[model samples]
Target: MKNKNVINYFKQVHADKVEYNKQMARLKELPSDYQVVYKEVQKFLWEFTAGDGMDMLPPMLELLDFFEEGAANNIPVLQLVGEDVGSFAENTLHEMQAKTRINELKRKMNERIAKKISKE
Candidate 1:
């Protein structure tokens, strides 16, 4: 059973890697403005990434898809994401329900504060 689990893990990893490569290739085909904005937004998202960072992959992929669509529709990247890019990035994180380092810190801080108060 353990051996089967190991094989499945490797297989899933391989599939994910392949999909990521295809996404990257599609990203490259987008307009220059879209490419730049997408990369910047992606980098911003990773800044708050937690755990092994695998939690970020889905959101990143979704962002890439949006960018690709914007490019296809000839829409300006800035218009799609709005002037406040960081806000857009935060919104994306919320929309995806992805956990980040900030979320972890918030949880820990609240828990510790509650514990301290309860002991009083």
Candidate 2:
């Protein structure tokens, strides 16, 4: 079952690769004016891929989380690495906030219990 999921994911990824190659070839055949647009698009993609420090941290953490979860769940290949590009940092921040909230709740509950025991 997991193998089938992996195979299907790769199939879709491969199809996207084929489509990207076709687009590049079409771009290559375009006139000089349009070639400049393609060049700018390539530049933007490069910048997006090679993001800076804080940008790098979120994806790294996300991969770790996905791996830990997958390992515990007996799943192969999380397939989360390249699936997110635009919202990587945003999602990680949200996860971090949720973790902090969980910790805060635990701390408050512990404090309340301690106060109740002291008054008894």
Candidate 3:
């Protein structure tokens, strides 16, 4: 019975994740301000999760901060629905750094090739 409950709980969590993703998609489509978006997201988290949702707030706020900053800078915010914001941010930064490193390596290779061609 305990095992059954655990499985059911996880199933519910998955369903909630899907619903949250759908809600997020719709929210992104509407015109919104930071506070409004924050509240809506907070409410959604509280509604879906069994816990108090406080643990999730910090990361959610971080993501909201990113959204606000992106909007101010005229940069597009990456929409990551149903993801942990801290993990998402960490992963995104790593991906960006990797891309930068790749580009730098490519530039160096091209420069070396150019120099060799010039010598020839």
Candidate 4:
């Protein structure tokens, strides 16, 4: 029962992420004029959530930021961000650090559980 609950919870979380990814992909295909609105929204999001961590922008927002920068720099509006997008080095570094920390915690938890089982 507990395992089923955990599986269902993870499936729901994954489903939400998949939906968000689809939305982001669709947003990426818009014309330059429409992209500006999305870029503005991304900028506002960063400002609202920044809290002194400029390096810690969300991954999707980082992509949007890249697109906005390209637009500012005279890149064609219809070009895919990947072709025109600049580096996400800083954001990638921060995200990788965060992922490492999460993985470390998971490893520690598993070790602790194994030790407990051995003791039993």
Candidate 5:
């Protein structure tokens, strides 16, 4: 996440604090692998967040719920993300990135660069 957005996010937490706390408690109850993947993915994805990452919240919460469901069902964590687990997180970030304003800007930037390079 952008540093400015991260700071803004923390500042806005008073409203979401209860829900966030509940998620954290659910996190604590997760299996170790789920916990590890969740933290790593969160850090990776945070770097891609735009506008306080408000748009990213729903999917992040859904991820925690997915992990919790898997754990409750006795499903192996790797089964959820697959082998080469880090890639799972990376792929997840890429998916989430698609919905952010930054990604749209990035698309436009690449298009501009391509056009300029092509002398069109």
Candidate 6:
């Protein structure tokens, strides 16, 4: 069952990747300024993936949160692309928040388990 859940998670991640690419293409159809920002974001993501240094998850989440807030508030560039882009940002933010919460929960659980083992 645990293995099945892992498999399903990977399958969902694959599907999300396909949709993410399509959305990125749509974003590229926006004005030049928006395209530039998108390209920078892509570069940041690539570097985050390729780098072999300390984890940058917190900063990456902060960046996403900034964009999400901008889109939700209808900031100029985000508004130019209309509601679809805003919605995408909102969804991404929610997903990231959920993942963060899950990670926190996992960390706590591991700590508790370790303490229990130490006491045994």
Leading candidate by lDDT? 1
Question: What TM-score does structure 6 among the candidates reach?
Answer: 0.38
Model 2 lDDT tens row, 33-86: 334533543343334333122232333334444544554565433243224433
Q: Write the per-residue lDDT of candidate 6 for residues 1-120, one digit (tens) a residue.
A: 999999997896676666556655655455566566555554544342322311334444455455555655657765543546645444444444333434556788999999999999
User: Residue pairs in steric clash, candidate 2?
Assistant: none
- Model 5, 1-103: lDDT tens digits are 6999988867777656767777778898998888998888777777777766656667789889888888999999889878887788777776663366568
lDDT of 2: 0.48
Superposed Cα RMSD, model 5: 5.8
- Alpha carbon RMSD to native, model 3: 15.3
Ranking by lDDT: 1, 5, 4, 6, 3, 2
Which portions of model 4 show Cα errors greater than 4 Å?
27-57, 65-91, 95-97, 101-120
Tens digits of per-residue lDDT for model 4 on 95-114?
43323434556788999999
Tell me which of candidates 1 and 2 scores higher on TM-score: 1
Mark the 10 consecutive residues where model 2 has the least summed lDDT.
48-57
Choose 2 or 4, whichever is better by TM-score. Answer: 2
In model 2, the Cα lDDT at residue 76 comes to 36
Q: What is the lDDT of candidate 1?
A: 0.83
Candidate 1 lDDT over 1-120, as tens digits, reads: 999999998897888788778878988899888888888877887788887566777878888888888878888888988998888977886777678988999999999999999999
Using TM-score, give the best candidate's number.
Answer: 1
lDDT of 5 at 58: 76
Alpha carbon lDDT of residue 28, candidate 1? Answer: 89
Candidate number with the higher lDDT (1 or 6): 1
